[model samples]
Target: MSFLPPWVGLLLALLLFGALAAWVLRRGLARQAANLAQVVTGEDVQAQAHRRIQQQHLADLDRALTEGRLNANQHAAARDELMRQVLLDQAQAGTALQRGGDGVTGPVRWGWIVLLLGALSGLSYLQLGAQQTWWPVPLSQRVQISATSPEQLAEQTRVWQQATQNRPDDAEAWLTLARLQAAQNAHAQAEQALARVLALSPEPDLWIERAQMKALSAGGVYTGEPWQWIENVLREQPRHLNALVLAGSAAWSEKRHAAAQSYWQRALGLVPADSEAAQGLQQALAQAQAASPAAELAQGVAAPPSAAAPGTALAGDARPVIQGEVRLSPELQKHIVTGATLFVYALAEEGSRRPVAIWRSTPTSWPVRFALSDSMGMGAPPVLSSLAQVRLVARISQTGSAQKQAGDLQVELPGVKTGVQGVVLDITGR
Candidate 1:
């Protein structure tokens, strides 16, 4: 059934109740009137019977007087007595009519009864009928389900849609819909649903959930409101596990290695060391440490020495270097943001994934010049001067993170030798 507005339903109820009360009052008054009419008719019938008897007695007295059976005084006295008795009967009938009329037709008696009934009904409604039981609640808002199949999930989604539309105040329903949308990878819709849920009850965990969805919707970049939400959660609950993890991830994405490490370390301490969450956290920390040159310096770890390659000298004075100019292709120039972080590094062609030498800068112009040397080595052996063959790579990170994320422009030149000068690296594509 279509739902009516609360005021409309209330008005309809009042109208129906009034109609019922008026019907009852009218029936009661008609019944009382009928009874009064019966009483008046019975009094009239008794008066007519008395008059007939008196007339018959007077006729018998007149016959007796005319036949000399009784004297004039006797007849006159009997006649007067009969007349007095008739007058008394008439008076009694008039009193009976007056009493019956007053009892049945009085407005005060019926009016008081109607008022009492109305008052009782109103009190009952206030005491018992004013709860949500009488209110029209959407069925979808009250039901809970676990949907395992695609069809069931669709059905569940429709049900929740109806629930949210019909009962906007139901926070739980909105939250359930948000989770369902997130599970389906509909991040935009999920974010919208989470917004409603947050407006209703802004909890830390819910804030984290919303931030995650918003970041996912924006291609895993948390540079806007998503970042703000994560910060809010951390501010409210510093030790919140999910918030800490997400904050660490955001910092890591933005190349804030120290902050990421700090957040993850605090979060790691909160979980069981042998748990899967701890294992994941350990892996992330290891990756962050590997990527961050400052992290290596902070640890004060040195790489083991290795034999130098042909034509490459280990002497600090004759250090092998590769100097290059990084340029964006014409087609990809539009993707580059001003002040974006540019990473120019040399990696060994064969073995380790770590960079032999790395250069980081925020470039404001195209055709940015970059030079990599052993002096910029990430505190490790197999530095730029020792590599026989190296791969030159240049990437621009719009988010300023060293990690390669989606939409970051990059280019790689394999089989490049150290001491190569004026090498051209083009960030031709994403």
Candidate 2:
């Protein structure tokens, strides 16, 4: 091999590269053929939108919203958007059809060529990228097996279960098992472990963990159930930072935006501004503000010496996803965030203090415009009409000293014409 000239080596290398490229392209085409069936069955909203006019069709909706045909949330949702293309097509039927009939010219050919180039670029990346191994997992099984695979997790879980089984009376083991189960997404098992651990004693971390689980996807993000758990812990230990963050995220996930804001804001105060948890909390706060400028805060109180406080109340953010009337105007939209952390819930009964019904905010919190527009008729919803007189306070709790005024909201977002419309609202910002 060393005897070959540099030009010969280059030639051989280019040949192999060409062959490898052809081989990779063939493999990609095969994958595309296999995925054709799935692609056919999937929704193509983007393609559909591309075919129609977005701006014109949304005009009526925009006008209606401005003229008070819909509320803020409703206006934000922009109803009849599904028919925008239809409306645009009908409006310009003759002209568009005539132009399309006169097509097949130089520009048309150039357009297809441009499209082809884009497709080729994507194909080239897909062909060449197969060899790039950014992940530690083997390429073949990467899709099927996650870095944190369930089987790998179950193995550790078994050891945790065994520890609890062998030492049934050990609170610490029970606590450890509860944490493991939650990590494993074994929610039922985690709850059981937490119950046993709670029977032993009030472990702040365990309660925080329990609250964290509730804030997680399983508890239906923002269900406020985590808040209840954290509330209990906060009742005994006001400065529990985990409880604070969990309480903030849980409250936010549960659609209690103001409560979430207050808890997280207070948690930031107690937490060092530069800490990981606090930074996360700040992001959550910023996201909340973006979705809606919401508020709360309370003084830090050290728990009693005998108390089982972890001394650090740290909880991850469950950034509230807000959905309701557009309390803030379009001018406010600038100040309002593209980031969302909103969740909206209806009372089990009209004016019912208990929030049996809930909407959750998570990493994927969507704007509560369209989805909840029709959910108003859903199970035990609040009958909110325009000009409903009500005053609400957002309470941020620490060790159970709740009702510390962290935030407030009026039933009506004064002066704005839109009324509240339900959606899985995201109150996002930070």
Candidate 3:
């Protein structure tokens, strides 16, 4: 009706179409049923009547051939056979019904069967599957895809280059291309990409990365960060290979030889000492050594925090370590050391009859057993998630040259132990 909404009219039309489909299906089923009834009753229908007319025409032709009144040699033979098949087919049809064939009781049409199946599937999905969650659909991928191999990496770099044509200022795209090219060991292409990254006029954070990339690569000193970027990285990750090499290069430029040696040594720890980068490090170390003894001493004396003060050791009484009965968590029994430096380490040997886990403390009853916490400058500590056996020893130094090792103690407990994880203060100042 004109009063109905457009949506209502669409629904009404769909309903009408559905009704027509049902009517057509019912009528086809009724016709099949009637034909099946005739087959069982042995009653001839229009089908059998058509077979009689065909047989009569064939008999007329055969009679003409038998009387030699017509040239029906090939034609009469075919007509005689055809009349005999018609009579046989009629007799069979009257006696028995065809099962699952083109006759009345044939299976439903494949097209209609497929349509019904699809509708049932959709209906079931809406009625049950859509209303209930039978299984969890995970939100994140469980397995991570690794970075591409060298061959694939080269192809991706070309795609990124083309994408940058439409978006010239896309810093992320350029950075990806640069890093990927570097991974593929395409140093020249990487240099070009890095150049574009620097040209984007990025912020200070980005500037550090750009500067590091430019100077760290073999393309030599990039104008990105002339003096500061590599130094900061060195200060944090002194053993970083690229960073160490850059620091050595910068120190050589300033004629600071021993600093170059230290940086090169640190770099050697991360990469082999005989690589091309190492060869450069050797040359710089030699040049810096020739011109930097006084400068090096001054620089060393300048950092009082790290350096042991001249003539003075720790400026105060060594902190005492108090150890008592250990408390076990549901899993572990750990010693509690409050207000003490936890010096975690490994014993040169585990089953010794002496101290294993050590803390930095002054009060020890001994021939001044000096324990240096050698864990400093070590890149990382063990993760807290696992159970591990740790060795510890405490030490106190009174004078710069005179050191006393007093209490070196060890503790063994359940591997899953939790306690204060701290570092010894540079008590050289204290």
User: Among these predicted structures, which one has the highest lDDT?
Assistant: 1
Candidate 3 structure lDDT: 0.44
Q: What lDDT does the true structure give each of the candidates?
A: 0.72, 0.46, 0.44
CA RMSD of all predictions: 19.5, 35.7, 25.2
Task: Name the runs in model 2 displaced over 4 angstroms.
Answer: 1-149, 214-218, 221-225, 293-430
Model 1 lDDT tens row, 99-144: 8776744575577567856875785585458866455554324434
As a whole number from 0 to 100, the lDDT of residue 186 in candidate 2 is 48
Top-TM-score structure, candidate number: 1
Q: What is the lDDT of residue 107 in candidate 3?
A: 46
lDDT of 3 by residue, 281-348 (tens): 55444534543556546556331142232212221111112222221232211222333222322232
The TM-score values for the models, in the order shown, are 0.37, 0.34, 0.24
- Which regions in candidate 3 have their CA more than 4 angstroms from the true location? 1-148, 199-209, 216-245, 252-255, 261-430
- If both were scored by TM-score, which would come out higher, candidate 1 or candidate 3? 1
Q: Show the lowest summed lDDT stretch of 10 residues, model 2.
A: 371-380
